[model samples]
Target: MADNAPAPPPLYDNTPTISEKEDPSALPPELAGPCSDQAQVTEEEGVASDIADKEELPLPPDPVETVTVTVMESQLLQKELPAQENPVAVEAEEPKLGEETELKQKQKLGQALQSLKEESNNVSDLTESDQKALLELKQLIEEALNEFSFSSPPEKEKNLAGTLAVEVSIWGIPLLKDDRSDVILLKFLRARDFKVKDAFTMFKNTSHWRKSFGIDLLIDEDLGDDLEKVVFMHEHDKEGHPVCYNVYGEFQNKELYEKTFGDDEKRAKFLRWRVQFLEKSIRKLDFSPGGVNTIFQVSDLKNSPGLGKHELRQATKQSLQVLQDNYPEFVAKQVFINVPWWYLAFYSVISPFLTQRTRSKFVFASPARSAETLFKYIPPERVPVQYGGLSVDPCDCNPEFTISDPATDMTIKPGTKQIVEIIIYEKCIIVWELRVVGWEVTCGAEFVPSTEGGYTVIINKAKKMTPADEPVVHGSFAVSELGKLLLTVDNPTLKKKKLLYRFKVKPLGD
Candidate 1:
């Protein structure tokens, strides 16, 4: 049966056949492992084996390196920090070198050592680290002192050629440097060191300190419940006026003084000389309310709170009043009488309109009495009425109205009545009683002299007046109608020929 189809491959089913799997243990070790060799094993594998062995092994009773860490007792790293030192101890520790003797020095040294011991008592509270650092610093300082001793002073001073020399403290601090040209040498002096006694000694010994600089001093005067200090400086001048400069604050270099003195050409030389020769210092000032006007320069006046404004206002008012009282009439008229002097000076020339208004009135009352009286007689209605070709001279009517010899020649135009103002130039005496007369009266004052030419009459008059005397005593009265009017003159000669007069006959209010 075709060998029964070879028994279908021995019933090898025509289906898919299962292959037998090989056990890894049954395989070669090299083939089963991950492509590794026992002789060339990696550290990772050795570590893994070691770990596994360690896991299998039991832990000892105690670890080999089970060491206990104990913190050593240190002065530092403590909870509470050491108390800081009080600086008062330091002041007492040092012996100040001042006006004292050897015994005083020893006493001061003992006090200093006691202060140091008291200060050291607090050192017990400090950390050992801090104490150690302080000790190291002190040792270093001592070493440095031993290396450079204080006893060895140099023969020539170091850094002294250009140093600043000073006799007093500046701004409350002692002056540094020691050069003669230092500005501090020219500043305000302190009484603590540069006492009057010292000053006299310096003045006597030092040629540099001459009379070029004004001496400033304060005198202690005991007043009621208070002491008053008066400060002053005297400037000695042989040729010029000896002026006393006020010592209020710091002494200003005469460089600024040039502005108040000499003309421009001489100012520069004078200022340079002053700056070189004149020496000064800061000074205290004593002042009063009235002295405000005396202030010449004010550059250093403080601007804060403006204390100067009040004083300035009072000073200005007083100055303006004085100016108004003493000025000449012409000059006073030019200046405006304002409340503030500065404003007046500022606005006087600028406001042309106001000036024009003030100057327009011709009736301005003159300060002189003579000039005032002249204006009164010049009013209208006192004009002369003379006809054309009338040459009736008052001088010609001698016996009744004795006119002045060397008579004044007056020109009157036809139908025009102009005021004639005459100024007295000389003094002339004229008889009063005998040289005066009245015009002729007809028909009981009804038929008086007519303007056409009835009567040429004269009264009291004078020819001239003295220099100090002013008499406005002449004018003519005219009648429009022919009627007589009464005339009266205290001085008959004055009415007849007055020395100075003004005549006007126009309608009033013209």
Candidate 2:
């Protein structure tokens, strides 16, 4: 075998050996057989080949450009200097009187912000955007309180926040109650879009106005019987905000009003009555739950006898100015129902006096759509039946009566009068419907109050009716004094005029 191997090849022989030919199992166990080692090396090589094949994929493209940014030595030195400031100096300065006060104020403001944030979290009606705006408004209010001084020596006496604390009061009435300051400040801030100085100015002016205008007195003052009838607030809207009805129609007797409240004393009283109406509405909101701070107004103009006179317009302007300037965003919405073309023109003229935000709240609706539109914000049950709703509280006292008689042609001679009387034991509504047979005669109607001794004209002005006009003439008056409600019709023409009329009276139930 040695001779054959010697003859086979040099050291680097290319011939196949017996180790490569034999199976690994056929080799001896004890010896480090070349067959087993060769087999193991071959297996590993196969695995390495598979891995190499798998990893032979295309590589990604290189970046388009390479940029290196470096801070200047001076900038780096500036940053390092601040970081190495002596902590002792900072601590020593923080205890100074002014700085300490400022820190306390900041801490207080932080607490207020946190409180408002937590309060906002509990409110279910606010949208995400509203909540964010509210938070910003709260911050602005805190900033205003901290930067500016709202307290005077006198005002500090009434401060709910204490004598040493910052005073937050409007007209000497503390606005910074523990439970409601956040909300109160928010209203002012929101009105001015969080402009601190502007809101502060507005709030201060409002406080002065409230004091001079006797807003506190107005709250307790009785509006008297006459004004109570003119403005009604019996129901609430769908949002649980109170609804105020201003019967512009009932204010038709300009001449009578001029006569009744002509003097300065009476005029002042009248103005106070108007102011009291608003104050009463606000008081309702103040006492209401869930922070209701708005009112829904409805101005009914269906039977308004004439276009508002100059004096009436002036009075309205003054009243609206008071509400707009002082109350700010109190009226959430205002619907003008049965608005005639002339009234629309009047509104257009006066609209310039209104702020854009206030004008945006007004809605004019026709009779056909009045109930439908009102129902959107006011539930059907809350709305009165006269406006085409389901409420029966003050049942439609507008009962129709026919005065037509088949026996006689129901004609009234010239200079003749027809008087009908119905006794009302208590406060009630008197509605009437009248029609003239022909277009020739002018018909006039008036309401009179009867005493046991004599009768007096309650409605001094006689409303004129023509054949072309609506056959119905409806009105309501409160009969506070127990007496007969007398309805009178006069034919002022020379010729005999065929007349037809009907009237209904119903007690005003609470």
Candidate 3:
């Protein structure tokens, strides 16, 4: 010991040295180092005093000095001691009743902060294009608010666009990128003339309609030859937007159409056909740069005889109303070519039902000037020759025998049976229209299984037919099993009769 160092205190003054080793099991798990030492000293005081008296140690020189010496030695020993091996276990023990609520609060706060950090990370990970789009969208929203008082969105809807963008991005919806969020929102706003409430309503309705209508499924639907001939989508226009042609003149056979679709079931089919046609055209548009969002329509009225009839006009009006209500801002331009003088009267009757925005898209052209006007929007190389341009017509030009005509046609003598074999691999519909030319004959039709190696009748029916019968049969069947669909028709009559018929096979819901 150094000469200047203070004299050491007596070790046995009824105070024993706190054991450096403590029974860890006796102390609470949370107590460590100094706390455990203190507990050990207090608990074993009697044992230490007994040992000291037995040993007969001398008394301390001063009680205060003894206490000071003991405290200093304990602290120094604690500093020199190694760390405990199970500090985590001690910390993980259930907290005291007084600290339980505070511990729980801290844990909850940590969790909340972690969640906030994750959300911030997600927002920061947006691509450059997405970031640009969001900025543009915000700018547009602000512009709408400043320029049009009614266009300003309420607080509830202010974040709606942002929410929708995030959802679409997370879900990976096709054709709906985060970058196009502004374009979609602008469509609703424009449709409602910049009224936020109305725009939101339109947006909601469209979302519901998309779900109910199954537009995504419709994109894959295959339209039959009959519907395809009437409504066809061709090459792109000058602006790179797809062009659709509706040959209204070909629908001159009003009586035939009425007889073919007289029942409510067939009428429903007609409505679906119209909607699917529009959906198909919509699916063809590309949303990338230099691509247009709207379609160009050419309604050919050349040689239309019954378009002026009241029934035809009424049907046209209803069809237009449905299109306008369900699909807004879809048609960029609608050009009517070879418009007859009588057609104007029918147009006048239906034009009043159209919105000003819709009517502004109409462009009427006479037969002589149709090509000149169409050339402005469409290149001469892309227009069909029938419209006085260079491109060849992709469709059959025959008035009676259109693309819907059957693949095979034949004349069957009396007492002869003609078997028609159709091969299909999915749910489909088969339609046939037959007319007896010379005289009445007994016509028998049956559907027989072709794969079983033995004839098993699926449908067997025979009926007497006359020229006035005008028999047209339409039926649908599932083709789960891969096989041939056999249709056997028998003509059992003494006199020779000519059977002029047309049959079509098409996919269901097409």
Candidate 4:
């Protein structure tokens, strides 16, 4: 090691020495090189002094005196710089219960944080206020689940979950109709179930109802009438058994009611039904029979109208008298007599005998065969509320006939002696037999038949025959007409022909 080392401090006092002022730069060329960059430094300036102190070091490194020894120092940095070994891994980290508890808590805390983050992420799309509102709503719904309900439903009954109520109306009503066109009417009734369908069917089916003329039929050209208001007489029984009977045209005419019932109290009741059915006098009549007596009255009559009051009264009396004559006891007891019409509504009331005064008797007389029979069979009833009789004549009184015989000839004529003639429309055979003392004469007289309305006979020519028109026989005069048969017979001998004539004839028409 070279031991020659001496350094002096910078001297600056008074007007400091040039050497001192010059500092190290003034000392040697080698040292000046180091101080040259500080040439503007002043002596008292700390900045120059700082430069001077740095220049005091030797300009050259001492070579021979220094031994160059190379040394490497490595400190294993046992400095334990807060140990890079994770505190979690140190000393095998024997987990203290509290530490373990703390670790679990920390792990739980991490999971909670992670869960919170996930929930936050899920709600991130909502505004902050909306998220808060949704959370509150959820809480409210949860609270509601635990509260009581004012109108709570019971636990659902199995198999009956939804159906809970029903409404009912118009359950039972009966419908009646006639059989002639029942199926068409039934189709109408079903179609009427729907308002839309019903309107269409009513318009289409108007023709079926239009045939009704008063009680005979029910129909209206306009669609205003109610279906229920249209009356129908059920032609069949409830079980669909058809009632078999002739519904005569006369039965449907109002005139028949007048003819059958006349002005009797029973007639009033019958009229009441007629009015109730349609609120007017029977413009048309419809009848159903109750008994044989009623049938007898109607069976023989034609169904024409215009029967006058007097005519109706006479007919009713005759019909009642016939019934009474046939069944006196029945009339006395007021046993129901069958009439042409059905039972009147009032029959149910005034039935059975009331008293002798009001009690009614009916008699039925056999049909008249001759003028005498007509007189005997026609009479007023033995007991009566009213007295009247019926006779078959254009005039009020019945006709009379007389037979006169003189000497051997007999003249038979009507009471008025009117000649009646019948014109034969077709060819027919006619035989007239005159029974006188039980013998018929052959070619005994000439005959003349009238041209007016009856046959007028003039007996003129007389002839005697060997075999007379007698015994199971008669004088047969065959008349072929569209031509004429004339007979003129004058009894010139003035012999009385007491004759009882019986004629049999047949008219053949094709």
Q: Could you estimate the TM-score for every candidate?
A: 0.14, 0.46, 0.41, 0.16
Task: Tell me model 3's lDDT, rounded to 2 decimals.
Answer: 0.42
Ranking by TM-score: 2, 3, 4, 1
Candidate 1 lDDT, 1-510, residue by residue in tens: 000000000000111112422222221111000001111110100111112112222222221111111112212112222222111111122443632563475586456334322111133554665445434433443342343321123412334563322232221223232221122221111111223233223222222222222112111221121101111222211111111221111112233322322254443332222222112211121111111101111011001111122332232233233222211111000100001112122223333533322232111111111121211212111111110111133453223122111112121111122122111111211111111112110101111243576763443232322323211223333333333332221221111112121111222122
Roughly what TM-score does model 4 have, to 2 decimal places?
A: 0.16
lDDT of 2 by residue, 175-234 (tens): 544435545555565566555566667767776677688776777777567655456785
Residues 427-489 of candidate 4: C-alpha lDDT, one tens digit per residue: 544433332322222233333333457564433244332223332223444444343332222
Q: Give stretches of model 1 more than 4 Å off.
A: 1-448, 451-454, 462-467, 474-510
Per-residue lDDT tens digits for candidate 3, residues 51-77, read 212332323222110000011121222
Give candidate 2 regions above 4 Å deviation.
Answer: 1-174, 254-256, 259-261, 286-290, 305-308, 342-359, 393-510
lDDT of 4: 0.23
Q: Name model 3 segments beyond 4 Å from true.
A: 1-177, 254-256, 259-261, 305-318, 342-359, 393-510
lDDT, each prediction: 0.21, 0.45, 0.42, 0.23
- Cα RMSD (Å) per model? 55.2, 42.9, 44.1, 72.3
After the best TM-score superposition of candidate 4, give how far the Cα of residue 44 lies from its true spot, in angstroms: 99
Against the true structure, whose TM-score is highest?
Answer: 2
- For candidate 2, give the lDDT: 0.45
